[model samples]
Target chain A: MFSQRKFYTPYTSPTDPCPPIEVKSYETPPQLYLGFQPPCLPQYASAKEALHRGTLWPALYSPYESPYKRGDTGE
Target chain B: MWYYEKKLQYPVRVRECNPRLAKFLIEQYGGADGELAAALRYLNQRYSIPDKVIGLLTDIGTEEFAHLEMIATMVYKLTKDATPEQMKEAGLGAHYVNHDNALFYENASGTPWTASYIQAKGDPIADIYEDIAAEEKARATYQWIINMSDDPELNDGLKYLREREVVHSQRFREAAEILKEERGKKVFF
Candidate 1:
């Protein structure tokens, strides 16, 4: 299975003014994993849940977690 | 032809007054890859696109309008009771001077939206590619907006919009392949 969130390390300078950002991360959309949507793909159980999730199909759903909250940022 | 919806596609709840946050949100509300641009671009291109993908464009284009309304509601609630000082501090001084808390079709930087931000290339492949890129860019903008905002309630709506971008992008990609498979195929007029 492909990971939705990805991380990488950035180069740091000896005399850098700000604290070095050791790790940086970003999200990959679900479409990157699936070549093309197929018919009869599994869907959310209820329309209300699908509406809240913003997609009817769970395979296509990709949740975004803020890097700031994830501690992936220098802040 | 469209029917009016009295409610927003997603609920927009702004629990606190934050003019500064509202200022940042104006980017999506009127920015190049914002909901309005997305809506206009897809709807305008639908007429010239292939019949197979026309309904996709129509449905997504219509949904973009609903997203636009949600952004408008969030901005409204965020700045409804903001003081002049708060507006100034929020970096909306020029906006207040001109629109006085009214929503303008301009970006966060105060540059008004222009048709140059979008394209209606008659080529179906080119247009569909543009639509896919637009979805990705909108998704990125939503992420940045979510980063800037700290209000959980507001983030809920932003997250929904961002997820919708992913869904739309997937649909557009599927449409592109659907168009691709039509290569060398003919339709009787």
Candidate 2:
């Protein structure tokens, strides 16, 4: 049996990115190599948007235009 | 055109004797549900099977020939240079005392070979299912032999035979699946 389909949000255009971000500093802890680091916070909106556009991080996109034809078209 | 080839799949170089194990392996040759029976069963049944199942039956039947050779080697080695005292120690005194180093064509229990082990009914589905059950039974016999053996060399041979049963079972199952699928697609309307 088929299940209900779920919709995902699309990604935003990378060229339109412009925002001010904050940086936090902390003292180095002992046994830094063995100790675990804080889990990464999720960016819900951006991730949802990227899913919709079929463009996610670590994935590249090609932006170009071509107008060419090949072979016979049953003419 | 003629060709003569002399090559053994398993070269037997050991001279030690283990008549008990040898007697047990003889089942593959002359026992009910033995390799000889299995080979003859599949080969003869091929005629009744659909064209699609012919290759599968042939391949399995050919492998049964290899199993027959393995069993023959085991019997030959077990009986070669077997001393009366050694036979007594291995609990094969009765066979050695009666057969006198000659390999009688018999099962592990010294039962004579019978043709009833093989059948070639003109029904492909029934025959394929029978082949599957036969392979499983052979595998079980191998397991029993392995459990009873202490010699590592003899155990290794039994292990190989056991693994082969698994492969043959799988192939027969695949053949059955193909038959079922083909029948399902038939247009009777």
Q: Pick the candidate with the highest lDDT.
A: 1
Clashing pairs in 1: none
Model 2 docking grade: incorrect
Candidate 2 global Cα RMSD: 25.7
Residues forming the 10-long window of minimal summed lDDT in candidate 2 chain B: B1-10
- Which DockQ value does candidate 1 get? 0.79
How much TM-score does chain B earn in each model? 0.96, 0.86
Model 1 residue runs over 4 Å out of place are A72-75, B182-189
What's each prediction's TM-score? 0.95, 0.64
Query: Across residues B3-55, which tens digit of lDDT does each residue of candidate 1 receive?
Result: 99899999999979998998889888898999999999999999999899999
* lDDT by candidate, in order shown: 0.90, 0.65
